[model samples]
Target: MQTQTKTQFDFIIIGAGSAGATLAARLSENPEFSVCLIEAGVKDTSPFIHIPFGLAFLARLTHLGWSHNTAPQQELNNRRLFWPRGKVLGGSSSLNAMCYIRGVAQDYQRWSDAGAKGWDWQSVLPYFIKSEKQQHGASEYHGDAGYLCVDDLRHTNPLSQSFVNAAEHVDLAQVKDFNGAEHHGLGFYQVTQINGQRCSSAKAYLSNAMARSNLTILTQAHVEKIIVEQGRATGVQLHINKKTLLLKANKEVLLCAGAINSPQLLMLSGLGPKEHLADQSIATIVDLPAVGQNLQDHLDVLVQYRCKSNVSYGLSLAAIPTYVKAAYTYTFKHKGMLSSNIAEAGGFDKTEFAGEECDIQYHFLPAILQDHGRSNALGHGYGLHVCALYPQSRGEIRLLSKDPQGELHIEPRYLSHPDDQKVAIAAVRKAREILAAEDFKPYQAREVLPGAEVQTDAQILAFIRANSQSIYHPVGTCKMGLAEDPTTVVDENLKVKGMSGLRVVDASVMPSLIGGNTNAATIMIAERAADLIKQEHSSA
Candidate 1:
């Protein structure tokens, strides 16, 4: 047996996902700090990852995706849902549909009200602006020069535009910016792209910082556990090339491995519930019962329509020529069909069951999507995906076993809450109404899913149980709250409760799920966390 050598850094960040990438870049900017970013996935060098429309291909690339599956949900007829999380450098930001929504201001207000102190919209808005390089330029709500590129879709399908038109025809205002003064209404989504290319956090934040000698990035490194001693996280033990090595952190060990991995890592490190850890025959370092609790995710239901024409993206022998032309167009001009983000046009709307705030979010796809676009359908069609933006249901992530590389017990328990089911039913009805609007008559052929026959509330509920899936937004597993709150894993400063020199800086720390896409919010969390880290060090 050989003793492994230990490498040291001023800061050690596990999981080079959205938050980790941002933290590494920001912390390393000061020459005094040596930051080490470790990722379990490979580099984001895949051509498909950089192309805007390549999301269709990237979703199925298991090499770059975690491809996690949830436990059977009792509400969804005991069917497990597929969750594709980014395993690469930029994390899900590299694989997600590039929609750059910042959610609504009230979402952050809810966080503050729920005990995520100082996380209200006003306090967090600047961080959002600081992370954005909006193509529309700076404004009271946006920034001019930031790392993440946010711009309108370079190309949108005709059917997508019609979806927006139909939404407006139904009295939904046409919003030019979803992240602006208001969040309600229909619009074309701005994406994390620059010149039709995807601008993942890796490209946005890490590209410039990679050249710095103070920052070191290691891919294909899987962290086994956090090395905690004397009630503090001092380093991490990871495996690379079948060799387990130790990496010490002089300042802090930050866990930014997204929702699922972060909680799983904590449990493996003997920092979870005492009973749960003891069941796995592991010594308990801390009895943080909330380490993997409070899991939440948006449950999305798709309403697909068979198009009257071939305008929607579909696969057929006749479409081969069109695809070839698109390839040429993308290679030469970086435009055309290849520049689309598939779910190009969407909106936020209030369902009849919603309160004062809009509750349902729509993601318009210019193609018939079956199983997150994994299956193929025959004809050209489009889909309107509606999700209950704020779900009352909560699930959890637990270890299936003590093995570091073993599968996790992911239970999002979608629609478990009665109100969540009621909202889901209403969202489906709303999507149907938008597609059936007079403005979409020219393009609409027929409702192919949960068809006109499936009109009754009972029928809609049945459809929801049989077909709903995750929109791929999972958060709140490692909730942030006051130190006295037993359900909280981390404090307002993101430091692990009852521990020192350790922090969780990713979506897992979200006290609750925001009412829209979480990528932007996750980045915002990282930006603010970076400042918190710097502030603490400066004061020290």
Candidate 2:
């Protein structure tokens, strides 16, 4: 048998996702530190990934995504939801909808209230601003000097603008910046783009940082286990080209593999639910009961409609000119419909009775989305993708087998909560009302999904149960809270409980789901975690 050589690093970051990339870039900035970042997927070099409209195309190219599907959801008419995670250098940030949202301030306050110190809105706001290079210039809430470039929607379609106008028609307040003083209202979405191209975390944070000789990035490398010694994570075992490589961590080993993979990796390395690990004949290390529990995700139901004119993404005789113009504009000026995020306009509004921040969000689309891609559309139409902001349902990610090569079992358990169903019904009704407003007269023809006949809460609920799918935001697997809380996996500082030289810094550590797109929030977590690590090191 041949033995593999072992290498070492100051910091070993698993999964080059949003959080890991940020940590790697920041931690490696100091000349004294040497960091190794490993990603399971190839480098993000696809041109489609950079194009705004090309998301629909890139989503179909399964090579770049981990297209995982959940078990049959009993509440959602037994439908399985498709969860696509980016398997590239930037992770999901490379493949996301590009909507830059900071979520409601209260969401972060809840984390501080729940024992996550220094995670309150005030403390985290600086990190949010630090991660953004807002095109709107610097302000109290936004910073001009940052890695992630945020540009307001450069080109919006007629329907998208009309939807915003209809929001005003229905008395929905409009805010200039959702990440500013308030996040409640309808407005144009700010996107993570530069020169009409998507600026994923890899592009934003790593492109320049990787130039440093201290930062080592290994793409197409999958981490198989966190080598632990007496309850301490000391290194990692990686698989590359069917060969195993042992890399030791001298300072710390960070798990930024995301919500699903992070917990799954922990379980694989004998640090999850004791009972499940025993069943798989794997020895338990930490026996964390909530390692994979507290799973949460937003499930959206697409309410589509047909239009009288050629307004949909569907190419027609009359709309060819529009498509041509859009293509030319994007090709020349890097603007136009080609630069539009399909889910261009949407907002957060609280449904009366929910105590927290807005419990529902709306994603408006100007095209008929028969499938995730526009390939299977049924003519010119529009749709509204709506879902509850907070779901009561919980699920788990357990190992399918003791084999490190096997995929983890994932059950999102969406729509299990009765309130979730009620919220969906209300959102659909609100969307209908918006479509019926006078502002929609020029664009609206008829309601296609759940049509006009499918009225009443019962029918809407049924439709929700039948069609609800994930918006691809999943978190809280490795929750962060006090040690007394058995469910908490990490402390407020992101260090794993009862473990040394290890931390889980990513979306997985979120104690509660944020109100909007989580990409920004996850990057912020990484930024703060890096600082925390530095502070601890300096003090040491």
Best by lDDT: 1
Q: What does the lDDT read for residue 442 in candidate 1? A: 79
Instruction: Name the regions of candidate 2 deviating beyond 4 angstroms.
Output: 1-6, 538-540
Question: What are the models' TM-scores?
Answer: 0.98, 0.96
Runs in model 1 deviating more than 4 A are 1-6
Q: In candidate 1, what residue range of length 10 has the lowest lDDT sum? A: 1-10
Write one digit per residue (lDDT tens) for candidate 2, span 1-540.
223343888899998989999999988888788899989998999978888888767668888888887877888777777888989999999899899988888889889888888899889999988888999899999999999999988877788878788777768887667788776777778899998889899999999998998888888888888999987899998898778898999899999999989998888888888999999888888878889988888888777878887866665677779888888899899998888778888887777646857788888888876556726554687887877888888887778887765767788887677777777788887778777778778765788788788998898888888777789899999999888889899999888887899899999999888988899999999999999998777534
Candidate 2: pairs in clash: none
